[model samples]
Each structure stands twice: as C-alpha cells, then as structure tokens.
Target: MTTQISGPRGLPLSGNLLAFRKDPLSFLTRAASEYGDVAHIRMGPSRHAYLISNPEYIKEILVAKQAHFKKAKGLQVAKLVVGEGILTNEGKDHLRQRRLMQPAFHRDRIAGYGDIMVEEAVNHIEAWKDGELLDIHHEMMRLTLAIITRTMFGANVSSNADEIGHAIEVGLQYISKKATSVLDIPLEVPTKGNRDFQQASELLDKTIYAIIEDRRNEPEGAEHTDLLAMLLAARDEEDGTGMSDKQVRDEVMTIFVAGHETTANTLSWTWYLLSQHPEVEARFHQELDEVLEGREPTVDDIPSLPYVNQIVQESMRLYPAAWMINREVVENVEIGGYHFKPGEILMMSQFVMHRDPRFYDEPDRFKPERFDGGELLKRNPQFAYFPFGGGPRICIGNNFALMESALLLATIGQRFRISRGENEPAAIPEPVVTLRPKNGMKMTIHKR
Candidate 1:
C-alpha cells in the first residue's frame, strides 16, 4: 500500500507558490523538518510537487528508478537559455552527447589544464592590492570566466568578460523567475522580461558562435588542446559522424554558462565561510603553506592537500551551488512507499539533506574534519551528502569543478586572506538557478 504524504497547507489558487517564492531554502527546510521524508506540495492549482528528502528515495528517483522520470519543468524552461544541449537533452540523445563529450573531461585530459588553471589564477590576482575592498564573488566569477574561456574554448575573453558575465546573469535570472512563475508567458511576446532574456540569449550566441567559427577555420592538421577542439573532432563509434556548428554551439553555450558559474559560487562561499570560521581558515592556510610551500597548486599537489579539499567539501555541504534537483515523473512510480503519477515533480535539495541532523552532527556548523578519512560517507546513506549529485546524469564536470576549486583555493590562499568587514552585513545566499551571494560578497583582501 502507498503511503499518504502530508505537507504544509497552502492557499487554494497558488498553493505553496507564494511561500516557495518568498524563501525557498527556509521553506524546503521547514517542510522536510515537519513533514518527514516525502512531503507533498501543490505548486499550482494543477501541479503536484513532492519534496523528497530520504536518501533511499532520492537514490530511487535519481538512479535506481531514474528512467521513470525526466528533467523537470525548470530545465524545460532552461531550454530558452541553454538550448537542447546535454544539460537539457533527454534519453538517447543525451547519452550520445555525453559519450562524445566524455573524453574532453577525462581525468588525464583535464589534468593537463592544471597549468592553465594556476597560470590564470596567478594572472588574475596580480592586480589585487593589499587592503582592497571588493566583491570577491564578482572577482571569482571574472577569474573563473577567464579560466573557462581559455581552457575550454581556447580563446581569451578578458576584453568582453563583463559583457559575457552580465549576459549570463540575465539568462540565469530570467530562467529562475520563469521556472517557478504560475503564468507561462511565451518568449515571442515583447514583454520586458522576455526582451531581456532574448537579448541575453543573442549575446551568448554571438560569443559562442564566434569561437566555434574561429576553430572551424583552423588548419585541418592543427593541433589544439581545448574542449572545443575535442568536440569538433569527436566522432561517434557507431555512425562516425561529428557535431555540426549549431550542435557545437549548443554544447559550448551549456558549458560556457554552467562551467564557470558553479565553481565561482563554490569559491565565493568558501571564502565567506572561511572568513566566518577562523580556526578552519587557519588550518586551510596551514595546508596550503605546507603542501605547496608558497608555490601555486598543481593537479598532482591536490592529493597532498587533503585539508583544502575538506574545506571545500564542508563549504559545499553548507551552501551547495546546485542546491536543488528537480525531476518530473514521466510514468507511474513508487518511492518511499508513496505512489507518484505522471506530471508530478520531485524536489531534492542538497542544501537540506546535507544539513539534516540525522545524516550530520551539528549540521549547520563549518567542520571540515567530518569528512576526514571518508568514514562519514561509509556511515551514512549514499545520497546523504551529494554535492555534485549521483546517478548517470550527475554533473559531468564534477572532477573538473573539484580540481579547479582546490587549485584556486590553494593558489589564492597562499597569497591572500579574504575577511568580512565589521560594518558589512552577512552575505545572503541567493538561491537562483545556482546558489549565488546576493548583492555580492563584499570583503577586504589582506595580503599574506
């Protein structure tokens, strides 16, 4: 027999839409705390949503019984920005794209980009003066953007970094708003929101397409080490065909948007958390000092700097970049003894699960040692601490993101320490498409 799921009550017309919109992090956290594992929430008059917090059930939806569900409405709306690339593509096409692009992110291939990562970090911090007050969030965004543009597309976007960053921000805001709004306004209508979204889309297209065109013009035998070169040369084993320029553009756009935004947020939050936790920050700095010996971190040096990785792990536990995962049921399925029908949405939040007292002790505190020796993972359920998610469709850039975060943290930590000002208010977690620091993370940069 299926279980009867219960959740917080809502108004008749919009159900929990208003509450969810007001403060999603707090709302979801409360729902999970009060309603148990499977909380049924009515998003709209016709839409049924369930917040699944159980690790076993989450595994069922994302992995064990994943075929029964598909990417939910938010990603469907994301098609407006990312197109039908890997992030939004479904089933066979998605698998095929993954297969083709897998080589570029392989351990060996991405390892080669470590030099570029450190070099970019070094170049980025060269202009940072002692006692400078700046938005570290924006600084990280700019740095990661430069790194991705050079490492992935083999182009330098330093000149247009601000424009590209603004365009991406516009796209993320538009997607976040439209994904939850009850009213479905078509983009064809020339409303201000739609117009801004379209303008952002065009700007992204112009930037990505230009890169694709340049690579296409390269000599046939010219060797290149970037991701774009790999995509252009990738041929399917069965059909032996390559991706067209349009297809390439879709994939590049997906990476260009997703690639930097997530890691930047991770770094920003790490800085904030370190600023708030001095002991943790001291240990983290000690690790960088001992491991790298005042030199920039390399991919190989990562294994020796376990504390740096741990600090990142704990930061992600607190404020995950991809905070929530949504899946829409495509067929009848049963999870945690609750029957789910087609069209119902399942909301799984890394933010909530990572902080659940059942899975973690002193859940809200910043303690990197919890992950020491990887024993906590063995003690808890699989989905209890998924920062990059699990299952087949997990973030493809997981390794890449981890490496970049470690390298950047170590590289930056070696040279400077970021601290929050006494007068500045706490940085608010803005849970947009990705969790970003609202109004930016303003901090004082002290040279070490």
Candidate 2:
C-alpha cells in the first residue's frame, strides 16, 4: 500500500481551475504556504497533480532518485514545436541524442561563439537612438536570435534580422495546449492553433532546411566557420557517421528556440530588475564602466566582471527562462515519506523556489551584492538556487545563455539606460513551457 500524501481539494469536477486561472503564481504561492512541501491541486476533470518545492525533496526526486521519473506528459506540448531533438526524446534515445549533441557545445566551440556574441550586441547597439521608447525584451530577442542564427546556420542565413524576429514572435505566441491538452486529436484534424503552429513551423523549416541544403552543396572543408559546419563535421565515433539532413534540422530548430528565447528572457528580466532597484543598477553600471572604460566587452572580460556576473546570477534567480522543472512518477515510489504513484505529475517551480524566504533574505528585493561573498547560493542542505533547474535534465543551453547574457549586458550598458514606461507593467508569470513575463516587458531606452 502507498502512503497517501494530500492537499486541500476543492469539490466538484471544476477542481482548482478557477483558482489557477485567476492567478497561477499567487494560487501556487498560497498552496505552498498553506500546505507545506507537497500539495495537490485539481485542474479540470483529469490529472490531479501535486506541486513540490522543498529543495531536498526536489533534489531526491529530480536527481538522486531520478530512476522512478520521466518527463511529465504536459511537456509534450513543447515537443510538438521543438521536434525530436535532445530536448524531447526519452530513455536510450534521449541519452544517445544528448551524447551526440554534447560535442557541438564543447568548451572551445562555446568560447568561439563569444566573439560572435559581442559583435552582434555591438551591431544592435549602433542602430539605437537616444531616448527611444524600446521594448528591451524585443530588442534582446532580436540580438540573441541574430547571434544564434548566424552561429548555427551559416552567416549568410540570417542577415535579414527583422523578418526572422517576426517569425519567432508569431510561433511562440501560438503555442499548442490542445495538441497536448488533456484531450488531443491527430494533426490531420486541424484546429486553429494547429494551423497557425503549422504555418510558423513551416516558415522556420523552410528557412533552416534551405540553409542546410546550401551548406551541403559547399565543399567539405569550406572556410565558413559556423555551428552548422561544426555539426556537419561531427561523427559518432562508434560508427563514424555524420548527421543526416533531418538530424541537422532538428538541432537547428532546437538552437533557434532554446538559444534565442532563453538569452532574450534573461537579459529582459535583468533590465526589469535593474529598473526596479536603483542601488543594484548603480553597482552594475560601476562594474560595466570600470571593466570596459566605455569600450565593448569580450569573452575574456566575463570573469573579471564579478559584480556583473553576480547581477546576472541574481537576475536568473528572480526570473529563470525555463521557470518550472517537471517530472512524472513512473512507479509507485516514496519521496521524503510521501507516496507518489505512476501517472502522477511532479513539478518544481523556479519561480516559487527563487522567492522562498527560507532560502533568500527579503526574497523579493534585488540585491546583487548579496552574492558577493557567495553565501546566498552556497546553501549546502539542498539545492535552493536552481534557475537552470537541478540534476541531469538541467538546461543544456545554460553556458550559452549565460555568456550571451553577460556579453550583451556589458555592451548594452555601455550604450543605453533602461527605464519603465508610464504603464506599471505587470511582471506576471505565464506558466507554460517556459515562464515568461506576460506583458512583453515594456520599457523606454535612454542613450548614454
């Protein structure tokens, strides 16, 4: 018999739908505050799920005790868009794909992208005008997209920045809950979101596949240094074979989605937090000024910018791009004495854990200096600081995301100052495949 873990269940089939729909973060906050580490909530007629935030419990379930879990069914919604890349596959296939993909991001390859990172940021900054009312989120998206597209696809591929940016916006806005909703129909049965998603996917595919086809026609030792070329050169030592056309396409799609949006969100929220708290902004500016003396930053500059590094650290602590980590219990198991059976959903929210008072002092305030002595993130009992997630499933794009964010922050700080517009934008958390700021993160830019 399984030990029955519990929650304050609402009556009727509606379950916690009303509560969840009204305000997800707050409703979740209330649940955790009232019910302790593990609590359940009902959403509609199916999938009675529990949200767990205790760090040790989270570590056990996601890392040390990982054998009993697989990704939640809910995340299939992303796979419909991201395809069968390392981000989606399961069991041996997942392990195999991850192994094949890891070499592409080897230390030298990532460090090589850093020069491209700084150049892209500098180009974006040159186009900006003083005192322009700009959306930092939009700007960061364009910059990161430009960098990733150039790095992954060949340089000739993404020079038309505006068009690619619009395509990405259209795609992310049309996410499919229905496809992976509690109820799903085959892709042949067209739905509104399905149609839009198909169009967006096609547009992206046409753009990517064209680039791969072009690269193939070029000589094997072509001089164009790019991620696509690196990927093309990659061979699985076991069989010594190169990636197929479709394999290349899946990876390109993954890099575009994973690389572009994550860096964009990190820089977006970093600016948002900076605008709200001036003291940290002062220190951030001081670091930027001292480090570069008004010139742009390079990958070599990253480690020296300790406070800037800490500011980015603090920013992700507050607003992780992949805000929630989810897993489904695969076998009847006991974790921290609570029972979980097959088919039950298990989630650890960075949004909730980042703000837990027990982990962070005055958790809502933005204090980059708190990380100066490395005390806040040094907690040993469990993992309280998991913005990129905890365990083996932690985002693979982490190093790429951090380097892109720091480089952009250094360059943008040299060029502009960000401030909030008249509308006090709601920093509402949208809990979908990734936690994002709901209002598009509106802000005005002042040239410095």
Candidate 3:
C-alpha cells in the first residue's frame, strides 16, 4: 500500500520554488497548463502547497465540507496585524465573533452606510481639479479612510485618520513580507519589519483605545447609529453580554484596515478599468443621466444601473484585491484524485482562476458586457466567479464591499470621466497580501 501520488515537479526539495518565485501567476498558470489543473509545489523547507482552480472542486472544499478546513496555516501574521477579530478567529471563538459582528453589517445597517458613501464620494469628486495628475490610489485611500472615520466613529475620528492609515499600511507590509520571505523573524526578536509593525500597531492602538474610552461615556440609545454604536448595542445571543473593550478594539482595528484600504484599492482598480474603456464609460453616464437626472446615487438606484454594476464586477474580476487564500486540510481529503494528508495547505488562486480561459472567453479582455445577465455567469457554479470566495467562510463583508463599490462607481462615473493620463506606467501585479497595482494607477479625473 505504498503507492506515491506524483505531481509535476523538479528535484524533490527544490521543487517548483524557482518558477513560483520568478512570477507567481505565470508560474501557477504554467503548472496548471502542463500538469493539469491541480498541482503540488513546495515552499522553502517544510511547506507543501496545492493549487486548486476547478469550480465544483472549489465549492466542495470551501462549502459542502467546510468543517474539514481551518484557515490557512499562516494567518498568525494577520492576527499580528489586526488582532484576533473575526478575520483571525476559529471554531467556537470564530462563531462567537461572527455573531457579535453580524448585526453591524446587516442590510439595514449597510443601507445607513450608503449615505456616507455618497456624501464622501461627492465631496471628494467636487474637490478634484480637472486635468491635474493625481494618483487615484491615494485619493481613494484617503476618501475611504475619511468615510470609515466619520461614519464608523463619527466626526471626532477624522483627526486620527492619517496616523491610523499609515500604521495599517505598515502592518500590511509586515504581514506580506513575512508570507513571502525565505526567512521570517519572531516578534519577540524584533527585525526591521517587525519594528515597523510594532510601531504602527502602537499608534493605532492608542487612537482606538482613546475613542473607546470616550464612547463608554455616551448614553446608550436608538439614535446613535454608526458601526461602533451598533457594536456597543450588540449582545451575544447565548450569553446575552456585549463585547468587552478588548474585543471591541480588535473588531475596530479589523474594520479600519479591512474596511478602508481594501475598498480604496478595489475602487482604484475600478476607475482604472473605466478609464481604459470609453464605450463602457459612455454607457455608464447614459444610465445615470436617464435614471437619476444627475442627482447622487442612492441604494434605491443600484438595481437600475445594471451596466454600472457589471462594470464594477468586471473590474474586481480583473484586479481582485485579495489574490490568493490558503486553507488547511484538517483531515484526510481527496480532491481532483489527489489525496491530501491532514495539515497540508491548499492555496486557492483567485488571480489564476479569474483569468482562466476554460471558464471565460478571452479571459484577459476587460468585457463588462459578458456579465450583463450572461448565461455562463448565472448557469455556472457560483464558486467560478468567487472574488470574495464561496460558502460560509466567504468574506462577511461581501455585500458591504459590493454596495460601496457600486455606489462609488455610480456617483463618480455619472459626474466625472476618469481619463487615462499620458505616459504613466501600466499596472504591475503585486501578489503578496493583496493583488495591488504596483505602479499606483495614475489617472486624471475630468468633469463630465
């Protein structure tokens, strides 16, 4: 009973590492092209990884048999960056955190946040000078940061935005570097990246703790209605108790970093996509002109702007912010005829799957029309287009993220045409923590 399951490989120890290191997407694509869909590769010393792209198989793993997998083996880095919020919890703790945080992200609560989304988008768009060369990435980041501050923590929070934003970015750098590095240092033994992470966390912690202290003084009422207030009002169903100060801080940290920067990057990619296609841009404007008469987009208007929604969907399909996620197999599992041992790591490649030719025609082409009530998008398994992953472990904030992107796209796309500036660098994919535009996406916002 000693049959060996083989994958396309090189020298046993030095397997696939060189190719993967050179260019991750290209390497994974090549491996799948040659070895057939699921391929196994080794990282550094003791890591064994598998690449999975089949939609049915992905659904089987992430959904049907979800209890069999925990988070990937290396999310310790995430805990370090954002503390043990919902993103970093598991088992009973994860379920508990999810329940406590669920009320804050509910549809009605998200609807309340929609007004903040429009107001912030309008304020930012009005201030932009036409033909000025500005990095949309920076602009989007600052705008989302401001929204998080004003809407999540109210007006008093804006003063702390800059300090908090810089810290979270630094923490992201640390987490990504640790994931990619051949060597990673323990936090106790402070290295350069570790120190940066420490300093950033310290700054953010001070600001958040101070805010929590002040919020404790506010009278509990139905009137105060930001995420923070909602969280304060939230109670555990079984125990019937509110989140402690530490739990509140952890969730707040997660919301700020996870909330702001990721949306900023997603919108940045979206505008870049819009700027590249004038025909799509024209259609987006026509939709707005016909529907709202140039008034701001609200939650009520989201369904009518089908093309606007498609445009955002297509943008995320191309430049998904979180490119890959790792899942750990907790028991003996069989996938694609490959039997995996417990503790083996499965790397689901979003960047690879989204661009795969098998599921999409000319997968590399930016075609919003493909998604407008298309056959494949509706008939195919849902996991095939999982920018937010599938099943229960799907990002708890998927609806929130989609709603924000749609409203921002509608609001800005209606009033301004983002023009492709001359002689700027094309987007370079950085495959670390999230797939970010390495060149920072420089474009001009022109008044419509």
What lDDT tens digits, residue by residue, belong to model 2 across residues 274-369? 888888888788888888998878889998999888989888888777777778888988888888889877877777888888888888888887
For this target, which candidate reaches the highest lDDT against the unseen true structure?
1
lDDT of 1 by residue, 21-131 (tens): 999999999999999898889898989999999999999999999999999989998988888899999999999899999999998899999999999999999999999
TM-score to true structure, per model? 0.99, 0.93, 0.94
lDDT (tens digit, per residue) of candidate 3 on 16-42: 666676688788777667765576777
Runs of candidate 2 with Cα error greater than 4 angstroms are 156-163, 173-176, 380-382, 422-426
Higher-scoring candidate on lDDT, 1 or 2: 1
Which stretches of model 1 miss by more than 4 angstroms? Answer: 1-3
Residue 146 lDDT in candidate 1: 98
| Model 1 RMSD in angstroms | 1.0
Q: Candidates 2 and 3: which is better by TM-score?
A: 3
lDDT of each: 0.93, 0.77, 0.79
